[model samples]
Target: MAAAKIKKGDRVIVLSGKDKGRTGDVIQSLPKDGKVVVDGINVHARHTKPSQGDPQGGIKRSPAPMPVSKVAHVTADGKATRVRFEIRDGKKVRIAVKTGEVING
Candidate 1:
């Protein structure tokens, strides 16, 4: 398997699924599973009993992991675009394939 083009903290737009078109920061990336958890997207309600953490037993909303293929990277200009890697200043950098802007640190 190859490394994911999107990393944690990167902004991404949902390309498919219930949250299609919604954009959010990447919370986590699971390359092995080909899934990524985006903030405030793919939310799932989980029922839990009262515990030491929460006395009120109710449904809790949390972001669930979705397939990595379901998302596309969002650029600084707020457009969804493909990514490509390039060598600049003796370092490897990720750039937006559409706008040619460096995306990696």
Candidate 2:
């Protein structure tokens, strides 16, 4: 498997754009595309036809995928920082650069 710096459920902060400084959990990880969708961030409106769930078919707010460069991993100390890999017990783990703490997926 490829090493993806960010994983699903990771708390991240937007580094730039309209969602700058906003923090949210990673809802999905598009590792192949190097883009992760964060909950409640990068939202965009979508128009859909009437479905069984919603007959109104009004515009719904959905999160749009943003480049991985626009976000950074949030460390345990509540700081946005870069992620690095470290080997421990023969297993590679993601470590937060700011606090040197292991991040669990």
- Candidate with maximal lDDT: 2
lDDT of each: 0.90, 0.91
Predict model 2's lDDT versus the native.
Answer: 0.91
lDDT score, residue 74, model 2? 89
Q: Estimate each model's TM-score.
A: 0.91, 0.91
What is the TM-score (0 to 1) of candidate 2? 0.91
Candidate 1 lDDT for residue 15: 91
Q: Per-residue lDDT tens digits of candidate 1, residues 2-104?
A: 6569899999999987888999999899988899999999999999999988999899999999998889999887889998888899988888999998886
Report the lDDT tens digits of candidate 2 across residue range 1-105. Answer: 669998899999999999899999999989888899999999999889998989989889989888888999987767899999999999999989888889997
